[model samples]
Target: MSPEQRLASLLAMHGENELVEFKEAKNQYAFDKLGKYFSALSNEANLCGQSRAWLVLGVKDDRTVVGTQFRTKTADLMSLKKEIADKVTHRLTFIAIHEVAHPQGRVLLFEIPAAPQGLPIAWDGHYFGRDGESLGALNIEEIERIRLQNRADDWSAVTLPEASLEDLDPEAIEQARKSFARKNPRLIAELEAWDTPTFLNKAKLTINGKITRTAILLLGLPEAAHWLNPSSATISWILKDRDGLERDYQHFSCPLLLSVDEVFHKIRNLKYRYLVEGTLFPEEVEQYDPYIIREALNNAIAHQDYTLGGKISLVEFEDDRLCFSNEGGFIPGSIESVIHADAPETRYRNRFLADAMVNLNMIDTIGSGIRKMFQIQRNRFFPLPEYRLNERRVQVTIIGRVLDQAYARKLAACPELSLDDIMLLDRVQKQQPITDQQARHLKKRGLIEGRKPNYYISAELAEQSGDKAEYIRYRAFDDQHYKQMIIECLEKFKTARRSDIDRLLLDKLPDVLDANQKHHKVKNLMQSLKNQGLIENDGRIWRLSNP
Candidate 1:
């Protein structure tokens, strides 16, 4: 069938839905907005189990072929693919751009390939998906569904026949032996008795002494990295000034077993001092916990998608934050899920790499590493680790210094609170979103106030945190207090304009409200006084009922 015929059939049968989007670029359409539609439509196609989705230009919402003048030139239209490819993850471009000459005018059908299984397509580092006709940020559930589509493939297990012991760094192999010995303390004598090949085989770095990608990634010589083809075991450490300019940089290749330390040492990690607050004395500790540093670096290596040919990045900021990023989407779907998972993740992108790392005492398979990072930060009264995940990469930011000392002190004092509770309250302090289930849990504990996604620490938390003044601002005055103010104003003036009542209560309303919300709230308060017969309004002026 002709392309236009197929589009007509789809419109007649399916109309506008998750898999089909119609746009009337009568004159033109936004480039950025079009990119967002690409991400959303592609993700929706994956969820719907379709091979492709349609972005039909020159069509209005009424299914009329109104025609689009957008990028009518053949070359101009062709350049859009490269423009989009530059910004999107994986450089996913259109499968085909068909310009159909309809009876009305020129109609373009851009065939968008469905997001690849296990990788949701991202536009400009953000995931988008459709909810029927609406386009918005892809929800967590949908993102996870797309990511878990194919979980069985393990790329690190692929064996490289040409690689040998000579290609492996001798020092890294010895370091691995020591790490293995530490992990298997009971097998020290036996471990020493085993030859290097035996140790490599037993350590799962190779498949029956056949060097696998995991071996080359962890213990291979720096030059041996080329054996992995496009993939490289390269870790880049960048030191950035407060203004975000690169001040110093270094890259470590292969023997990731030893390079992890080199990257760690490059970080400033200066001694951080918790300032005196209330009765608590100042205490000093390393800005970054040693465990956090190793766990983050090791996790990045273990979870990195070496197939992407991208170097693992460790960006150290002078502003007391460090960001570690690797080429791969977070497999657990969300960091919160990992931090709260009751059981370990059942799948890994690099199962062989993970198993080998476990044998080398590099990481645990139980998935408690991420959770422990959070606890360590909470115990130190620092902001919890922040994770930024997208289809292209998993980035984690660790803050070294205290952002809210009173809040930290209050949390430190609360020995009865569980780690989960402290984490939620920490989210509130950070102004991050919490799940509805989490919101209810915190509300049940009376630890937060206000609405979903906008919750503030409750008076209990604020009062205990030594910030009652701020809490009062968020808590606002009682309705009766505002009502009495209205009554006093009316009695004084015999009558008052709605603006006067608004002026009295707008500033006094909870700071949680936006300007529009504050104004709406004042209107509601005046309405209540009128309903209570304490005052009346002539749709313009309000006065005491008796007056």
Candidate 2:
């Protein structure tokens, strides 16, 4: 199908929105301007509840089929796509680009994908918004709304009125004290002086010495979980084979502080050996860090969305990845924001309950749980923890070993790379979209190459990538060079027939037209090119506007 036809089909499929536009490209199309458009359209699309927005080339402001001659060479055009993708956060890239041929000429089509949940796509470190037809900076209120929209539940603070001190297991309470003492050594002295009720109260696990849902979750006996009401509290730990098939599963009851140890004991923590260059001996490592496991289990117990009637799940896959999925959306902000700020926000789903867990030292009050997870993984040379926040839930997956040697080496080689940089690169390795700024940053660091069809590699990674020859074959074209070519061609072909124009320009153009559609193709190309100020038409004659 032609680019124009495909765009029409896409528009019909998506329906009308303030975000999508069919522009004639009549004025010079600046890359920076396009970047602003991306931010505006993406944000507008999200606010308007649309999945995507389009910037269709070769159409006039009035939706007229002016036909485009915007001769964006295939490689040069791809650079535009890469430029946008690399700059955005999460490495968000276009879904696809389509070129269409019409009787008047050729058209270029850009399909921009929607931003991920809770994460708005920004251009060059700032977000853009559309106020009616005019694009401007995104307002703070809009940003807050986007952030808040994803959160559905906060399970930590829910009151269990019927739950009392008796609901907690005595064994669990003693275990909690030991764990708390281990985490807060300074508290050990004070902890010994306080009675169980006072300690529990101080820990925020109980209100006025009465049991709370936090107490039940952290130290409640398995049988007492039912007494908490509305939902039963449980944690299921599963051991899976290398293929991700479950081999064994065990369920732990609430008053989870003590039961966490029972779950931890099920996983084997053997010594692992790694080759250290220039050394005769291999480096010995633990299979999984004890602190990480404790943190993961405690985090699950503390942040679970019990209102969903879902139990916190810890799944250990054979592929050496540990996944913990709780029943709630992530708190409204980037994981980086939470870590870097090192302060809990005022708004929390379960403020009171989280306070109790913090006092007990089961969870950090500063909202550094995720940051700590990243630090631990980095220290262990493991892939960073991956946090997936959807509309309904938050899933965190931590890989125990290096999945890509090249990626690991790249990270190892660059000790100066910040945690945020590492997180962005990890997303790239996982084939997730990133912003244009992020793409440029990675390119600058020599960790990745190409523009749109980009790939990450250490020097060793390029060798292991297997398709080295193919990577070299798809070299991106220089935009300035291609633009110059378009100008020169239009100058030389003054008054050239449509057929002649197509013959001169077809090969280098974007892949938006069929081999047989040369007549319609030339018409669209001249139209778009003229609009972009690359060429000017004097009745039947065409020439470069400035040159």
Please name the candidate that would achieve the greatest TM-score relative to the true structure. Answer: 1
Candidate 1 lDDT by residue in tens digits, 1-547: 5676877786685468998899989889999998999999989998998878999989988789888899876557756767887787766767657777788988888888788778898999999999889999999999999888767668899998878889999999999999999999999999989999999999999998899999999999998988888886889999999999999999999889999989888989899877545656778999999999999999999989988988898999999998999999886556644554434555678889999999999998676898999889988889999888998899999999998665686776566887767877878788777765467667777788888656877888776667788787778667789888888888788988888877777888877677988888888887787788888767797778887
Tell how far residue 309 is off in model 2, in angstroms.
0.2
Query: Model 2 — which ten-residue stretch has the worst lDDT?
Result: 467-476
lDDT of each: 0.84, 0.67
Question: What ranges in model 2 sit over 4 Å off?
Answer: 1-162, 179-193, 339-342, 431-436, 458-547
For residues 94-196, could you state the per-residue lDDT of candidate 2 as single tens digits? Answer: 6556666656656667776555556677898999887866779999998877776657554555557777777778987887787678767987889999998
How well does each candidate superpose onto the true structure, as a TM-score? 0.63, 0.57
